[model samples]
Target: MREMNYFIVGDVHGCYYTLKKLLQNWDSDRQKLIFVGDYINKGKHSRKVVELVRELQYRYPGTVCIKGNHEYEMVRYIEDGTKNSDIKENFRNTLMDYDLRNKYRDDVKWMKRLPLYYDDGDIYVTHAGVNWLGLRKFKENSSWCVLRYRGRLKRMSRLQVFGHTPTESKRPEFNKKSNAINIDSGAGNFDNMSAVLIDDAGKIRKIYTEQIRKEDYH
Candidate 1:
């Protein structure tokens, strides 16, 4: 296997320009880029962001992409044309980010294939934090467990890294007691996009980002 350093990026939303700026100096050969989902909605250029992520995975063999709630909604919309107004509104917003909203079936299929979580011994990457309240009852394949759980895990074996609930400071939140880290810096909410870099020993090296503002895009 190739020696690789993992860099997990939080929700990108549709901030394509900001994400592009953050990846300007990334090295695909020696590093693995893992995205903690929510790549669409709330900003512009959702299509480009998805395209870029797909391109990166193609170029880098070890790249990993986790599924987010937004993706789940997309899959539901495609499969059943769900009647939930909230889901419909969110999916519509996501589609509007792309010029070709009518042709998003392929993206829905791609999201459906994405794994909910990834485990690499030292660290665990998921879209949202695991349900600590019900470890014994937790189902690995449960969409609610992977996409909606929020609280910290009670007895996590490895360092849990995730991005779903945005931090108040618009930065990655780390709790040593729970051994959990939240990296969703609210990029979907028109804030900054953050990347958490970790080494083989499970040490977080740095957290960096490129800011996004609604005014600038407007």
Candidate 2:
């Protein structure tokens, strides 16, 4: 049982360079990279981001890549071409970015199996915040909960961290009232990319993409 630090990153919507910058100092051997989903769509290098995540997961054990709504739509579009309209319009760009528009079956298959959330007693990580009804209701809602629920959530026994709703603020959104942290400050919503480091006891140390690209720091 190797000791590992938990690092959660929210929504990497095709910002390949930004994601690269964020991981430049990451210690994969000792830190677990938990992505809170929405890894694709809205960015130019969606393929590269996916590839990088796969590569990192291969190099590091305990790395968790939970699925986002975009992934769910991508899987649907891949499985049934006429399934989703929004994704269908942007599907070519997404596939072409990786050198394929109607293929990459393996990647699609990989995305399909991504879990919706992860919990480890003290912290809860999901693509979106759990609704006010609580965890049991969240489980019952499943994809709806992970993909659509919004606003401040009710406080739970553990800290809840999520990233589906993008915030205009440059920093990750933290709600003291609900004990929820939103890390989706990335270019997915045309803002800076943010990543948070959580210690074994659930303390947060946040870093934004501009830390390395200081010229863009605002």
Candidate 3:
């Protein structure tokens, strides 16, 4: 079997232009693109970002899109129509984006089916890093631990890559203690989106970033 390199993307959070620009570095012929979710909300182009992600999946058969906390919250909002003001506030931009495009129902369905994580033996990609004892629990319950956990991660057998809590430096952060990486550059909330290239051996080769364009978030 051919060993495929991975381009693990961070939390997109609806920065379509930023994602579009960063993806320019992806080499589809040799690299499998993996998105660590949070594709919508917080920014202005949630609809466009989702559409682009779908298009990439359609065109690239091996693309992996893992579910993030934002996606989980979105599903809950659609299903419960909860009166929680915080949830409503968090989803305001995304809801408006999909409402204008009339794609909320369909998009929610797609988001619901997304897997919580992606593991390729050599590397494990998820929205949040699970603790040493939490992996099995995360699988059994699909709980918030996998989607929202922000504590220090335990070192795993394989390299762990995740994005949820944005890096304070607005760049990918590597933790030698846990052998993990956090690639969320806070695209929707900050100025840039980030991605990391990992080789077949699970070693991060490089980091890529794209500045969020005003048109993408305004």
Q: Candidate 2, which segments miss by more than 4 Å at Cα?
A: 1-3, 83-88, 99-102, 135-144, 211-218
| Candidate 2 weakest ten by summed lDDT | 209-218
TM-score of 1: 0.88
lDDT of 2 by residue, 1-218 (tens): 77667778878777777888877657777677899988777777778788889988887757999888888777766677653344555565676555433556778888888887899986899888787766453452354476657765868777788987777676787788888888887556557777887777777765555422332222
- Report backbone clashes per prediction: 0, 0, 0
| Candidate 3 runs further than 4 Å off | 83-86, 100-102, 135-144
lDDT of 1 by residue, 1-218 (tens): 76678788899887888888778656677678899998887777778888989888888768999988887767766687555465556557666555333575677778889888888898888888777775532353464477767665655777889998999999998988888888998887787889988887777888887688563245
Q: What C-alpha lDDT values do all the predictions have?
A: 0.78, 0.74, 0.83
Worst 10 residues of 3 by lDDT: 135-144
User: For candidate 2, what's the RMSD?
Assistant: 3.7
TM-score of each: 0.88, 0.85, 0.91
Best by TM-score: 3
How far residue 215's Cα lies from its native spot in candidate 3, in Å, is: 1.4
> lDDT: which candidate is best?
3
* lDDT comparing candidate 1 with the true structure: 0.78
The C-alpha RMSD in Å for every predicted model, in order, reads 2.8, 3.7, 2.4
